[model samples]
Target: MRVLVAPDKFAGTLTAVEAAEAIAAGWRRHAPDDELDLAPMSDGGPGFVDVLHATLGGELLVTTVEGPHGEEVPATVLHVGDVAYVESAQAIGRHLVTEGGAEFATTVGAGELLLAALGTGATTVIVGLGGSGTNDGGAGLLDALGAVADAGQLDGGPVLFAGLSSVDLAPARAKVAGVRLVAATDVDNPLTGLFGATKTYGPQKGIAEDRLYEVDGWLEQLAEATDRRTSLVKGAGAAGGLGHALLCLGAVREPGIALVAEAVGLASRARAADLVVTGEGAFDFSSRSGKVPYGVAEIAAEALRPCIAMAGQVLVGSREMRALGVENAYSLVDLVGEQRAFEDPVGSLQALGERVARQWSRE
Candidate 1:
């Protein structure tokens, strides 16, 4: 039987490619005759550069860029002809920030990465904006790009910065006069509101409640200064308002997973596969709302193929997934203890794969 193994990163443990390898290893151990296809996946967040580079045959360009805390960090981007694929999280990601200093962190490195990619003569830059550590609303990014923010008259302006508080963007905007920026995001939230960047994701990024309002106010001010008046802009709140920043800089926002999936020919793969397996770190009610697995499952379902999901944890039962066209669901945590399972992630993945294979073989 033919089986396609496609999974997202295990979050702080295994990358999507590594997870696929582990599952393949286990499946091979249990069913040597089975044909296994591995397609590592992402939702346009971290691991985006690697996956796109591997799939699209791009040159990986590595450079030293500023980190969130004003330190130099090794960051990479993918160059495919005139198009450059950039993952914003790599330069200023949540994983790079420490607890105490994350509050004042910025996306300076992200801007540097963009500049580096643009310096390669790549006309179009595709930035995967998520998993960021900063709440600076891309002020540092604009600064690195030579845009000066005007903090005084933000409330009403034709060229508004999305989140600059005391910062300015006039100088930064002057540097890149003709570059097009495209932001890929999974979220659809405004830069300021109840569902704004700070209120929705600040706590996870280590920002306190008292400071949430402060950040929101800053975002409003920046929006006004940049002359960007579209608060209803979809994905404006993504990647700690990186989306908003991109919007202010004339960037177009698109659903990240769909764009990447299309570029990777995900639908074709699903159509040709006898069975498809896709998953992420967790599967819950949220998984049904345009996540990676949900997107893959939709394609698989349309092709009349059965799609199964194997996650680190399954918060929603099989019944919920059935409505979403998932044939079955499996959780690594359910089969093995969470702590023990992650200790040897490969081993645990292989064991889980073997069990799943055995069950499929019986049918």
Candidate 2:
């Protein structure tokens, strides 16, 4: 039997590679004779850089960049010639700001990453914006890019900024003027609306309900000042309005997972594989809406291969994924106790792998 182990990072517990290794270990324990293929995956989020680096063999460059809460954090950029891949989450991710107040968190560090990429003489920069910890409407990012935050009116909607203010972009602009910027995002939300960044994700970032409207207001003012239209653009609200900021900087937007999948040749891999497996930290209603599993399942479905998913947790059940042609869905929590699994992810993954291999080999 041939089993493909393709799983996303288990959030804080394990990376996709680590998870795949655990699963392979478990499968080996039960069915040593079965062939197992490891194809760790990502949805163009936090682990995007690592996934690309491992699969594509890029040069990893490490540098110091500001964190969400004004602290310095170590960040990396993946480069292949003039094209640089950056994961914004590495600098200003929710994981970095989990204990900090949302009011002060910003994407300035991400902007620094862009600057660093430009410094490397890379003409094309691909920024993965998924796990942000800021709701400042990309004000911090613009600031790092030589734009000045106007914070006009102080209504606190979307914090807008003035492009080319007292700060001169002449030097940096000369270096990056011809460079192309691509913002890769998974969400389709606009900069400001009922489903805007602050409205939908701010609460989770510790922003109070009363302050939500203010943040939205600030973003609107910033948008107006910068002469960038915030509303109506799909994905304009992604990454705490980082989408809007990039738009203002003349960046193009693309579906992050689709782009990464194409870069990594997932379609061809799925076509050649006898069986395909893909998953993430959780399989829920959201999984159907263009997550990694859905992307992998699409390719597997096209290849007419049975696609199975192994997740850390399965919340939406198997029926929701049926339309996507997912043949089976298994959760680590289902095979092992949640608490114990959380305590020892590798062990849980190994056990889960053994169970899956036993079941598949029996068939």
What is the lDDT of every predicted structure here? 0.78, 0.77
Tens-place lDDT per residue, model 1, 197-245, is 8789888988777777766776777666554565458788888777877
Question: Candidate 2 lDDT, tens digit per residue, 1-363?
Answer: 776677778887899888888988988998887777777777667888988888888799999998876689999999987789989999878888755366667788888988888777788999988878777767677777776333332112133332323223244344457889988988888887689888988887878888888777766655565544544488778888888777767788988878888888877777777788777778877876567888788888887888988888988655676976688888988888799779999999888878877777644
Model 1, residue 344: distance off in Å is 1.1
Model 1 scores a C-alpha lDDT of 0.78
lDDT of 1 at 127: 94
Using TM-score, give the best candidate's number: 1
Model 2 superposed RMSD (Cα): 3.1
